[model samples]
Target chain A: MTTPTQQRLSLIDVVNRCDSFPYPSDPRLERLSFLTFIVDEIPCGRIHSSVVPHIVAFNQQDRPVFHITETTISFMPWLADYDSRSDAIAQMLNIWRKAPKSFPSLSGWRDELYGVYTLNTSPLTTKGGAALAIERSACGIFGVHAYGVHMNGYVRTGPRPHEVKMWVARRSATKPTYPGMLDNMVAGGMGFGHSPGYTVLKESMEEATIPIEIARNAVPVGTISYTKLSKDETDSQPETQIVYDLELPADFTPTPCDSEVENFRLWSMDQVLDSIRSGEFKPNCACVCLHFMIRHAVLTPENEPDYLEIAQRLNRRLEFPGCKKWPTFKEEQ
Target chain B: MTTPTQQRLSLIDVVNRCDSFPYPSDPRLERLSFLTFIVDEIPCGRIHSSVVPHIVAFNQQDRPVFHITETTISFMPWLADYDSRSDAIAQMLNIWRKAPKSFPSLSGWRDELYGVYTLNTSPLTTKGGAALAIERSACGIFGVHAYGVHMNGYVRTGPRPHEVKMWVARRSATKPTYPGMLDNMVAGGMGFGHSPGYTVLKESMEEATIPIEIARNAVPVGTISYTKLSKDETDSQPETQIVYDLELPADFTPTPCDSEVENFRLWSMDQVLDSIRSGEFKPNCACVCLHFMIRHAVLTPENEPDYLEIAQRLNRRLEFPGCKKWPTFKEEQ
Candidate 1:
């Protein structure tokens, strides 16, 4: 009897015996990071979860410096102008904290938001005053997005901070593709030459039954930039991804019209982080989103008053001239 | 964002909730093991390659014991009797050594052989007795097979076992199923109450360019039995499977008439196994058949020549009333 190794050899030699001709002018492929959220049970207690931002800043020796604070990691890209760097970072945080009002809103101050952010890195240079070079040559803007929904705080009886009931629509078990999987509330590609906001809005309306106006209000949070790798040798260009954060009510409900979403549910901050750690969440993008929330302390179980105090402290920490401490947790209010 | 635990809970709760009302059984609701070959490359020196079998013994303990070996496996029910076990095992080894006088030959002999052997385990008892319980139960049988002409031994310039000239019929990638898949020989299970030999023969003729007489002489090599699990209260009854082994001439040539097989090539054994490992050879019955092959070393390279020898020795060892090394491979081999 032929062994598995033998069988595999036969198939491989037969299938790949012929020399493969290279195709010129093919678009370079890239690898990009996607974020998603995984909410566990409804918030019921003071949940403690560790946060790890995807971004890493390397020192002279290419070593990472760990920083923990009350909210948000301190790994923002450095700008040539110190003031501009601080301003840009503040703007990004503001977008994350308060849902941008410029975008449309769900009925009665309820809304879902999705956004994309893009950034590029400059090559290391000996000259100190060199102009900041866009990393576009090596990395191209590919996609960015963020989406959120609002719900009444009554979904769970515990302390509520404007509950944002969010659930990933389970992919249909019979779906022609990605069957029996998890899907995000809103999904879109940046380089597709389509508007991420518009795409997410359409996706929200079609998938989660969120009203069109509510999806439109999704504000641009901060832009997240990352590089991607390519699987094909012919395509080695790096792809960049931009991300935006949005806010929603706690009591909001989603009515799925598409069969892709078998069902949905709500989760507490602890449950969400636990699910992420356990690898139970679907649609990996959801896990990224949840990670962001944890790192920012945006989904803690604290009541509104406590949450406000925590948020205030976080804001103060970010105001530090050279805040090395990545946000760890807000002092108990 | 909802967590995975929340999603799992919701799914479980929904299923439980629906269970309150008696539900009708779906015809497709059956325990199915999908098997396929993954061709991989390994260093074997002058030996070229060897076949290893992986077995999934269903309902053995509770989940199933996946046993791997370097011996041929079979599942023909006719060989269930202890007396037939010896001849059956010998016949299987013979098929591997000497290809039967059939067109489309046993190009996929390893897969078929392994499949049959795997099916045999379902009827094995804890005491290692033949558990032919499946004979009294209703069962469905189906198989998807393919002949990889490029995988034939003629392609290799090593010690030429036989001078066989053959071509493969290419399958259409546009076809609804098994698109672009190579096929020269294929056959599968006979539904309950049907003649296994007749069913396989019909399939051979239909899918492979083999003569009926040669197919008939393919011979029954061994029997694989499965034992049902009593722990699964959800599944009221247990199930079993049995498979047969056959061989064809090394020099056999085939002319595929089935549109499913579009093109053909003559490949060495190395190529064939490689294709299976690499997933280039996609057979319709891959799931179950592969499962069976893995369980039973129908055509394992290590035991190809000595399967009969080993089986005979095992029988001899069993005959010894007070054998100390009963279950050990060292004593048996």
Candidate 2:
């Protein structure tokens, strides 16, 4: 009889897969080529060099939305306010959405809007300084900052990290992005007008069929950030994932309530590590697992060679402004 | 009845106190002036501009230890090997130690050596690449990366973040640095020849009188790094503190076993936060507490405005080299 083989991965390798960009301290970054996405004279995002011509094409439109320079693509000075800019961008995206072959990034057309705030403004606080809100799918194309909530739902068999088991979800094969990939039990984008707390509660119930009473216990932990340069080099995704931890009763099992998740499984720490090593987990989802392990002490300085670097890289400080406060649903109304 | 007023601080305020340096991504950093400390042509540390005159005085010696330039100070070509470099630096430091009036940083004279390594090497891996070792007290003067372990000893009253209470230590009034300030229950320097695991266990007992069996349960969670510029502009402290979390039995109480600490007390999360706000805790120690809060979900994305920034700042990636793998005691013997 043959024994089963186990796959292994270095902790740094797992982190590098998610945070693929060179470190900000690296000298090579000074020579890298990318165009700036400017709004109100503030450099807010990194637009891919390949996407410059497409943006320049928008400037030729009857009502030009953007003013294009050699190294920067900025909103026209006339479109100063939030609603005007949002409407102009949305109109442009809708036109691009019509031609799926030309603009592949707008294919999903997530109808949901993601707010782009300046460093001085947060969604949950003052509303005036918000630069614009655009379709969630277009966030990557423009290299704007995006936000989401990822929660590790787990059951504790003992007090130690080794004894803890996590509830992992498998995305439905029919889903648009990262289909059939492993993911956190409860995960959702922080769409405009919703807080991380609200997103956690909403996603937990919709995706996992978890009761609100049980999901209310989901505690907001910290965040994991990365600027993932798409494999094709056409998209730059600078994202912040607000992480949470929910300890569920061992007796209660999670069942897929929506088409988003294919199934859920209670996995041991070893199984999680093995799956991560084998590349069965989504890059960001794997990063979320690494964050969980670091907090739970399953991965420590003794066992992990890149403990400090991993911790720092997991929460990379993005140059573009992000929402310091997540607007609650009640506040939005 | 009138209630006692409680001191309060924003989480960003606590993190800013430790990571006071301009971020590496900040444009203003390019204009900041400092000289790089070069070891065997590898940029290893930062030297305060004020200390350049003193380093120049050393070059006037019959056998100069360093080759100085306007922007950088490099070790002399004659001192090519580890032993030669270590001895030459030590000799100069000893002379400086005699006249503490001029070289105030050498006054502590702890006699513990800190190894300086290139980015390509670690103390636990190849031993030959260690450029030199110098007294710990003078590490800040040279701006070399120093290491330490800080463990938070706490008791879990419940599963929630606020349900835990920490064992806080008050440093002795007679202590040279941050005298009478609040600190973690157990903390100690990661000397030249010790791993973080060994340091945590050793410090737990020496500082808090914790038993070996109990101390061994301290789980290494993560690390907090900062580049602390001295108030007088005389020293640059780029240090990394390996952080651990120890959940003690509810009945167990920590007692001061060494003269470093005057007393220990179990403090509520509120009390700890208040103390940190009141400036009763050392800057780095307060950062460790914030790290605990972030991990335990006390300070979350919902509650802290600077949640992402604080998390990133707490683990600032040092430009200089640090030991990736710490040397075990067995290896040293």
Candidate 3:
């Protein structure tokens, strides 16, 4: 008689893996003084953090970028006299580009945009001053929150939906961040111009070679948020990641179409669990996978003792400015 | 061409409907003293509150149920010497039954049991001393959090997968709580001695006449939790609802096997939204429907502005004894 060895992971181990999400300790985010950047007496962004000193120094030569008093910084409304208000911003950004030491980027351009809001409730109030590039917002250059979309792609197998096979992506070794680490099959930033739905569809096709029809059917599950105070306490990185789930047919496979992803492979739940335990998957992507597992009955409440805690902790409260003026492509389309 | 009067809700209005979850306001919960109910030095339940005066006043003739002090109240551990805890609890309940005013139930029985726990690691600690009835716990008589199962039963329809039909139930007029309000097709308190899986199966059969085989397939989705402080500020109703989802065959219909439900109906998403906007469904049940809508992709982030907030708020943080040793029927089986 053969004695069977226990192969199933204990629920606590799975919950622990989900709980082990890593946060980057960027010292720049800490101890920032709040300086509201106002446009025509309305709030546009939090412009003057401790980084304000650096911004002030960077603006020494170019067209007096800001008129800063002790507590507040206001864009010179005369900027409207310029050809484009974005040009005024571009001039400042271009100055920083020359030094490149202050603002670091492998690719100089972050084509994606984000909304900057004001107290005045109308587009006439913006005066061409309501947009920021994708990457700079994470540094909280102007103290604004950023948004994105992440997806958990999976295939079902075994008899009677008994097993989950996750499609995992290995980040390209040459990628700027978390290179060679594991990731979800598709993930992308939700920039100013695109809706969460449009962004997901676009990213799916570009990153995973997933067709538009399949991507359009992706489910909007929920969100995960975090407010990371940079290691120096000068910037606040407040981000909200809207999560999605795309269930692929058993025969479906994901292939990387871009340099961002090195390749894609399907792994059984146990193997995924092993990799997570070994600290392999990108922290946030691991959380997305865990959230999917909890919802799909893969981790039953009975098996997981911390079930309630895990569910509540997955989507933490984000400290982003309340998103009233944010526009999306989904609604516009 | 006739101008079509707008009949459908905008995505934001639907999202706001999900956001309007209300919590009961009670002054007592705001200032309750913490009295740890310890078992072998591991804190188990918060045994006593300002409500203890009321419990003491109600149990005047009982076998002195508690050992109360200025800061704490404890059960007589010697009660464990008795073979059947149900009998001892039954005797106290019988005394309350005679008064009826203090312990009121239309059926005079909750018929629900919740696990009582001690921290020796595993089910062996449950020797019948580890369970309490639902009503008593609600009164803070035992200081334990009650658990239940709530489900969303949906039927898919329409071309392009654009439509979803939900199976909703109307609460019976004579039901003691939230009478005539709408509810999920399947819901039942996870009374003592049953696992989450077992209870879902049992409740599905009794509540919706869902066949056992189909009920067995009800997926363990996630959980929702809230603490309701009573109107008079005397009692705290802390509950952890383990939510489930069972996709019914499009042809299958639920019939009321018990009078707890007046009837079941398959309503399109629009009708459900209207009823929810009018505050017709029990608050938790309405949120569950939104959770289902989100997971099914009926409510997308593009359409709902508060998409992130709604998803995070669905599983509110619960204030129960952290569930480390709670035993469920599934674990036992």
Q: Highest DockQ among the candidates is held by which one?
A: 2
The alpha-carbon deviation from the true structure for residue A282 of candidate 1, after best TM-score superposition, in angstroms, is: 4.6
lDDT for each residue of candidate 3 in A1-333, tens digit (9 for 90 to 100): 112453444433544443332232223324346676655564545653555776688558656767788778766656542234456566666666665555544134565456553334444545222433333433356556567889888886753333778889999999877889999889987666566778888899999999998887787777766554444444444566788877789888888898899999998876776676556777667777777778777766766666777786676544333344345454546
Q: Which scores higher on TM-score, 1 or 2?
A: 2
* Model 1 iRMS: 34.2
For each candidate, the alpha-carbon lDDT, in order, equals 0.30, 0.82, 0.64
Of the pair 1 and 3, which is ahead by lDDT? 3
Arrange candidates by TM-score, highest first: which order?
A: 2, 3, 1
Between the candidate structures 2 and 3, which one is better when assessed by DockQ?
2
Task: Give each prediction's DockQ, rounded to 2 decimals.
Answer: 0.01, 0.59, 0.34
The whole-model C-alpha lDDT of candidate 1 against the native structure comes to 0.30
TM-score of chain B of 2: 0.92
Candidate 2 clash pair list: none
TM-score of each: 0.22, 0.91, 0.74
TM-score of model number 3: 0.74
lDDT of 1 by residue, B1-333 (tens): 223343222211221221221111223323422222211111100100122221222213442222222322233334444334434333433444353332112332322311111112233321222212121111111111111111111222332222222233456677664677654344444332233345556656665667876665443322212111112222121111223323456566655656656655665444443444444544322222222222232222122322111221111100001101112223222
lDDT of model number 2:
0.82
lDDT of 3 at B176: 79
Task: Write the residue-wise lDDT of candidate 1 on A1-333 in tens digits.
Answer: 223343232211211111111111122212212221111111101101211231221222243332224432332233333234324433433343343332111111212221112121122311111111111111111111211221111133333222333455556687654566444455433222233344455667776787866665453321211112223221121111223333445657777777666776565554454444333444234333432352233433111212211111111110001101111113211
- RMSD (CA, Å), candidate 2 to true, equals 3.3
